[model samples]
Target: MHQLMHADLARAHLHERLADAERQRLAAYVVRVAKARRAARRAERAREQAQLRLRLLIN
Candidate 1:
């Protein structure tokens, strides 16, 4: 009975660790996605500005 209780407690601890790791991983992924989106937006704006400059030079 003592061994059984020990086993159950170990299992619970493992599950909690796994849960915390998953939450951290998910949060990191969210941050990465946000950064990627911001980079894309900046690239798009830069492209537009470059094109406008080209048109002005041509005209």
Candidate 2:
């Protein structure tokens, strides 16, 4: 009975660790995606600004 209890505790601990690792991975992914989105938005703004400047110069 004692051995079985110890085994159960060990399994629970491992499960908790796995869950924590997965959460960390998900958080990292979110950070990467957010960074990419920010970069894309900046690029879009720059392109729009350039177009505006060209139109002004032509006028």
Candidate 3:
């Protein structure tokens, strides 16, 4: 999943560089979205692990 996000961002960056002048703006936006998605996923995993640890402590 992380790799997928990485690839998506890379592709978007590449396209931003290669795309026609008009489409480059959208490609840049796509790269930002992909980066945000990757950060969100990492945060979710960390939250889940913390919750699991709290559960273990309570039990």
TM-score of each: 0.96, 0.84, 0.61
**Cα-based RMSD of the predictions, in order?**
0.5, 1.2, 17.1
Estimate the overall C-alpha local distance difference test score of candidate 2.
1.00
lDDT of 2 at 53: 100
Q: After superposition, how far is residue 19 of candidate 1 from its true place, in Å?
A: 0.7
Candidate 2, residue 24: Cα displacement in angstroms equals 0.6
Give the Å error, residue 16, model 3.
15
List the candidate 1 regions with Cα displacement exceeding 4 Å.
Answer: none
Candidate 1, 1-59: lDDT as tens digits: 99999999999999999999999999999999999999999999999999999999999
Put down candidate 3 lDDT per residue, 1-59, tens digits, no spaces: 99999999999998887767668778899999999999999999999999999999999
lDDT: which is higher, 1 or 3?
A: 1
Worst 10 residues of 2 by lDDT: 1-10
Top candidate on TM-score is 1
The TM-score of predicted model 3 comes to 0.61
Which residue pairs show collisions in model 2? none
Positional deviation of 30 in candidate 1, in angstroms? 0.1
